[model samples]
Target: MVQAALQYERQRRGLGGVFLDEIARIERHVSDAPGLYQLVEAPIRRATLRRFPFGLFYLEELDRIVVLACLDLRRDPQMIGVTVARR
Candidate 1:
């Protein structure tokens, strides 16, 4: 979990910096017991980046989350899924 957070921070910096507050909000929701993210019922779903025209799609696993992709809003999300599946 520590490594994931560190990796997220490093990648976020390289991506021109994510909003700290937004990251905090997401982390809080994601980490909550039973989790706010659980309200999203799709097998795959979109989570908008607070101040960017991008989205993250993740797969929740038994013990870890797989971030499927960070995607441009203008692109087809289905394509992103296909791309991630190939990877």
Candidate 2:
């Protein structure tokens, strides 16, 4: 996520902050409504970031959400799935 922010920051000033703010907003949504998203894999659910091509993969447990990965949507679907599964 730092890498992404850096890349965005390089592209334009304050863009990285914008990206991070969007991430925080989506994270809060996930925290507020754990089951609001659909499952991406057997036990993993995905919450897509607004205005960006990234997605947050997580596992909804009995008491908390375990974040698996923050991945780029532009990558190969199989690769993203594998990355999230490994985490």
**Backbone clash numbers for all candidates listed:** 0, 0
Per-residue lDDT for 1-74 in model 2, tens only? 99999999999999999999999998999999989987888789999998999999999999998888898999
Report RMSD (Å) for each prediction in the order shown: 6.5, 0.7
Clashing pairs in 1: none
lDDT of each: 0.55, 0.92
- Candidate 2 total steric clashes: 0
lDDT of 2 at 12: 97
lDDT against true structure, model 1: 0.55
Query: Could you give candidate 1's per-residue lDDT for residues 1-87 as a string of tens digits?
Result: 234345556776643334445555554555443233423335654566676565556666678656666566677857766765664
Cα error, residue 30 of model 2, in Å, equals 0.1
Q: Candidate 1: worst 10 consecutive residues by lDDT?
A: 32-41
